[model samples]
Target chain A: MKFSILVSEGPYTHQASDSAYQFAKAVLAKGHEIFRIFFYHDGVNNATRLTTPPQDDRNIVSRWSKLAEEHKLDMVVCVAAAQRRGIVDEGEAKRNGKDATNLAPGFRISGLGQLVEAGIQSDRLVTFGD
Target chain B: MTIKKFMFVNRKAPYGTVYALESLEVVLIAAAFEQDVSLAFLDDGVYQLKKGHSTKGIEMKAFEKTYGALEDYDVTKLYVDEESLAARGLTADDLCIPVETMSRAALGKMIEEQDVVLSF
Candidate 1:
């Protein structure tokens, strides 16, 4: 079955991103397809390359970035939410006149339409949120 | 593209957090997809449709007015949990818009019928 996942909380402060990552991994292990992984609200924080954890702790952002890379996943960060939380890509940074871009690899900023499209395209839409 | 049954499950208060407003924004955008869209209001989410929202003191946009525009978007299926409303001392008349009030079990059946359930 194809599934679309919605992650709605930030890393460290919430377990939503971690749980979503584990679920996505399990889905892939079971040979199911992930239609898309959409980050909304505080969940957009997962796409920022600026996230840094201690040497011992699990690196949440990098984990998502790597999994997305290995699976060729479509990881989308909501543009409105990302802008509100300051998670900028090169294009967004240039358009908004910002000095730097912090969007992590394997994730792209997009509109909420991508989320609706995921819901329409996928067989199931599972949400991980607060 | 095939049309799907999309339901937005709202379980938070309106102004205390950003979920209510952001969820509304998604609903408006989802309307453009021409999918069978519905909204479920339970817990504090029932407060989102309550009448007479005054956010001037808090400096937040009183977005309750936007609910009135939902009909124009062709997204009019709004379901309020009856137990949640009764627990909050509110009734259908207290809401700013017309909605169908159903028991939680009935709502669950409706939710089970959905293709995509997006909780907020």
Candidate 2:
């Protein structure tokens, strides 16, 4: 089955992002195709490269990037939500006249249309949030 | 692929968090896909449909009016849990839009029938 995952919370602040990450990994491990992982609300925060964790702790942002790299996952952060939370990509930063961009590797910023497309194209659409 | 039934289960109130508003945004966008879509309001989520909501003092955009746009989007399956409304001293009359009220059992059955369930 093709699965699309939506994450709506930030890393560390809640268990939502971790649960979503685990669910995505489990789905892929089962040989299911991941249509996309659409991040919204505080979930967009998960795509920021600025996140820094303790040396012993797991780096959630890098973990997602690595997973996307290995599987070629289409990880999208909602542009509207990302802008509101300051998770800007290079293009968005240039367009908005910002000095910096923090979008992590392997994740692209897009509109909510991608989320709707994920739901329409995938067999299952699962959301993890508060 | 066949058309799948999608249910968006909203169990939270508005303004207090970003979930309610963001959920609505997804719903609006999903409408364009022409799927079998429904909105279920239970727990404090029932408050999202309450009429006369004013964001004047709160300094937030009053999105209560946006619910009215659901009709224009061709997404009209709005289900309000009767128990949730009664618990909050509200009725279908208190809401801005016309909605179908269902018992908890009926709501549960409806949820089970859906191909996909999203909660926010």
Candidate 3:
């Protein structure tokens, strides 16, 4: 099986992100392929590398980064949502002359049309929402 | 793109918001175009499947009854997540319509088999 996941919920506050992570791990273990991971709405929070959890708690941004590094996954954060939440990549931050870039290497900023394309291209489109 | 199967994962409460209703209207119109349409309710969305719901004092139109009309639209693949139901203290018997309830794993499998999946 192959899939593209749609995430509409943020980390820490909702189970949707956790569910998506679980599903991704299960799919990969099952020998399935993931075409891309589309983050929308609050889900873009998953791509914000600046987030800092308590010292003992798990950092979702790091988790996603590690997963992408191992699997070469496309962690896509929606441009509109990222901007609305103030999550900018290096390019965006540099272009806008922002002080810093909060997005990780495994993640890329994209548009909703990519979501429509993901639905069109993938064998499966699973959505994780709150 | 030509969509063969269309699935709408309803995450919002049926009332007090326009997202769910607007989404339903979109799916209905899609079904009219001869697309395969299905609805899966999760989280607070389980409240959307309950029966005997009426909105009078709230001055909002009752959309619960519209579930019946879905069949007429050929939008018959109704599903509810088992955990979502238990957490909400709801059951299929409490619903006005019959639904195929399954675990998240099964639901994920179903979603993977669809051509397009939308959540609201």
> What is candidate 2's DockQ?
0.67
What is the per-residue lDDT of model 2 for residues A15-43, given as tens digits with 9 covering 90 to 100? 99999999999999999999999999999
Model with the higher TM-score, candidate 1 or 3:
1
- Look at candidate 2 and give me any clashing residue pairs: none
True contacts kept of each: 0.90, 0.76, 0.29
Q: Give model 1's docking category.
A: high
- Per-candidate Cα RMSD to the true structure, in Å, reads 0.8, 1.4, 7.6
* Clashing residue pairs, backbone N/CA/C < 3 A, model 1: none
Expressed as tens digits, the lDDT of each residue in B1-120 for candidate 2 is 446687889999888898899889888877777778899999999999999888889899999988999999888999999999999999999999999999999999999998878798
What's the lDDT for residue A29 in model 2? 94
lDDT of 2 at A12: 94
DockQ scores for all the models shown?
0.89, 0.67, 0.18
- CAPRI-wise, candidate 3 is incorrect
Q: Model 1 misses residue A53 by how many Å?
A: 0.8
> Model 1 chain A: which ten-residue window has the lowest total lDDT?
A118-127
Once fitted onto the true fold, the runs of candidate 3 whose alpha carbons sit more than 4 angstroms away are A94-97, B1-114
How well is each residue in B36-116 modelled by candidate 1, as lDDT tens digits? 999999999999999999999999889988999999999889999999999999999999999999999999999999988
lDDT for B78 in candidate 3 is 93
